[model samples]
Target: MNKIDYKSPIGLIEIEGSAEAVRSILFVERDEIVNTIHHETPEVLVDCLNQLDEYFRGERHVFTFPYHFEGTDFQQTVWNALTTIPYAETGSYKDIAVSIKNEKAVRAVGTANGKNKLSIVIPCHRIIGANGKLTGYAGGLWRKEWLLQHERTFNK
Candidate 1:
């Protein structure tokens, strides 16, 4: 799989995948050294970076590049529901569970949301707590808050 690191406003994002599809887009610590041998950047990865740039610049609201998620059926369902969240809106785990027709799976929905590897593209950050508070985010809650505020700034 090909890989590239993007210096996003929130932090460093490691984009990984093959020429055909993106596998993951995760935030990495600045000091962490990625051991992959450097190779030519795939066109798909380039497109993803470009779109990310547009997003951070407040010029893009949706991601159009191809991306793939590796997870269980339930996790995929939760991730798909996350995509349905509007660009500048927020939803709760219960909201996701309801959208997936598994309203009682709120906790499970939160678990699956944390498993989402495709970050902003899949929009796991949009999921807040049931009480309307920021909650768990693999990339850190600060980044989540930043992302939400960033989207609101652009969406207005």
Candidate 2:
């Protein structure tokens, strides 16, 4: 797998993937940044970085690059549902459960959401508490708030 670190507006982002498809994109601390020399970066990783740049600049709302998700079927289902949420919009765990035709799986939906490896691209940050409050985000609530605010600003 190939990996690269990008300094994003929020923090450092680590993107991992192969030439075929992007495997994961997650936030990392400064210390977590890997030190490795790549002879040549893959085209896909470079493309993802450009798209991310566009996203942070508020010039792009959707990601069109190729990506791969590795998780259980339930997790994949939840991730797929997350993508359906329009840019700058939010959804609740209960809402996702109902969308998947499993209204009783609200808690399960939350669990699956936390397991999401791909961050902004998969849009796990868009999920919120049913009460309309910001909830748990693997990337931290502050970053989630920043992302929401960022999108809201650009959505206009």
Candidate 3:
């Protein structure tokens, strides 16, 4: 897999995959967040950096890049539904299941949300808990709060 890194106010972001798709976008681990980008990065990372800059700067809300992910059919369905969630708008896990027409799959939706490797680019942070409380976020609850708050502060 092709891997690349770039700097962000949030930290060093690692983008991985080929031109046909971006497979993952994640912050370096918390311990590595502040670490300088150490790997030799791919030239293909330029688009990732551009899109990410726009995202953080609030000039862009929706991503135009093509992405490829590996997951079960159900996980893919849930992730696609996540993209439909408007930036700056919060949805519940139940909301996601309803949108996917699988109200009984709320737990599965939550599981998929946790498995989201593309992270903020896929906008999983938009999902809240049943009672609107923040729930499981693989990137860490504080980062999740920061991302959702960032979008609300600057969403177009």
Candidate 4:
């Protein structure tokens, strides 16, 4: 897959995919290196970066790029449910589980959420604790908070 490291407001974001679809969008620390790097940003990745720019600027709420879901069937189901979540709205793990017709899988839902590879586009940050508090995020809670707040502020 072709990859590009984009510097977003939160930090460096690694975008991975091929010319067809985006596979992942991950926040990276300073000096972090991914497995493979692409010298030229593919056409699909250019759209990804542009949309991300609009997202950070609060000019875009919904993402339209194609995505490659590379995970287990359950994980893919959970990820698809995540896309149904409206921008700037929050959902608990229980909510996700219930939406998937497995209300008892709250913990499992959270685990699946934790495994989401794409960040802002897939919108894992929109999921919160049952108590309405922020929870675990691969990009760290601060970035998650920033993303949520960002969406809330510009969700017109």
Candidate 5:
């Protein structure tokens, strides 16, 4: 997969994918070693970068780029439900589990959320704890809060 780096409000983010589909958008920790660099931006990546720029600027609410999700069926279902969460809105793990028609799978929903690799595009940051507290995020809780606040700015 091709990879490009963008400096975001939270930190440097690595967007990885192919010419046809975006694979992952990850937050890169400060001082993290990056061994791969593809300076050339394919059309798809350029589009992804543009959308991310719009998102950070509070000018966009939805993503239109194609993304490739490689995961188990349950994980993909969870990720799909994550996308259904509107911008600036949040859902609980239990909410997601129930939406998927497996209300007893709340913990499994959280686990699947942790496995989402698409970051902002997949909108896993929109998932919160049942108590309405911010919860586990692959990008870190701080980044998750930042993303939620970022969307809130536009939603209101």
Candidate 6:
């Protein structure tokens, strides 16, 4: 995967990935590729760029590209639950734990959300505090709010 740069409203994004799939996407002030697994072009990367563009424009609410994120089994379980969060809907850490049949794993659910690598594609923004307050996010809370607002504005 080679590093790629994407211009977004917030800033330029740096993502690492291979020809078959994307591994990660990071926002930065300038071009800085890291941990890229360079792969064939016009295939995996082409679709990634297209979806990313649509997402930034609020024209896309879901992603359908192939990704290869690595994580612990528990983390993957929590991340999988995140995908079930409706496009513009929100959920609590407790809600996730219940969905996964681990009703007592609220703290673990929060940890899983904190470790999510797919970011917007996984819709981690939809997760909030139990009281509905915005909580942790790898992308920063401001970005989370922005994403949720972006979804709400277009989802209707």
Q: Pick the candidate with the highest TM-score.
A: 2
lDDT of 2 by residue, 1-156 (tens): 899887788998999999998899999878555734366778898899889999999999999999999999999999999999999999999989999999999999999999988899999888889899999998899999999999999996
Question: Please, what is the whole-model Cα lDDT of each candidate in the order they appear?
Answer: 0.90, 0.91, 0.81, 0.89, 0.86, 0.78
What clash pairs does model 6 have?
1-17, 1-36, 1-37, 1-38, 2-38, 19-39, 19-40
TM-score of each: 0.94, 0.95, 0.88, 0.93, 0.92, 0.87
State the local distance difference test value for candidate 2: 0.91
Model 2: per-residue Cα lDDT at residue 43: 84
Model 6, total clashes: 7
* Candidate 1 residue lDDT tens string, 1-156: 888888888888999998888899999988554633355778898899889989999999999999998999999989999999999999999999998999999999989998999999999999898888999999999999999999998896
Clashing pairs in 3: none
| Regions of model 6 farther than 4 Å from truth | 29-42
lDDT of 5 by residue, 51-85 (tens): 99888999889999999998999999999988999
Highest lDDT scorer = 2
Tens-digit lDDT track of model 6 for 1-156: 556666666666666677677887666656443323335453666677678889888788879988876898988888888999988899999999999999999998888788776667777789998898999877678887888888888896
Which regions of candidate 3 fall more than 4 Å away from where they truly are? 30-44
The weakest ten consecutive residues by lDDT in model 6 span 33-42
What TM-score does candidate 2 get on C-alpha atoms? Answer: 0.95
List clashing residue pairs in candidate 2. none
Model 1: CA > 4 A from native: 31-39
Q: Count the backbone clashes (under 3 Å) in each candidate.
A: 0, 0, 0, 0, 0, 7
Top-down lDDT ranking: 2, 1, 4, 5, 3, 6
lDDT (Cα, tens digit) per residue for candidate 3, span 95-117? 98999888999888899988999
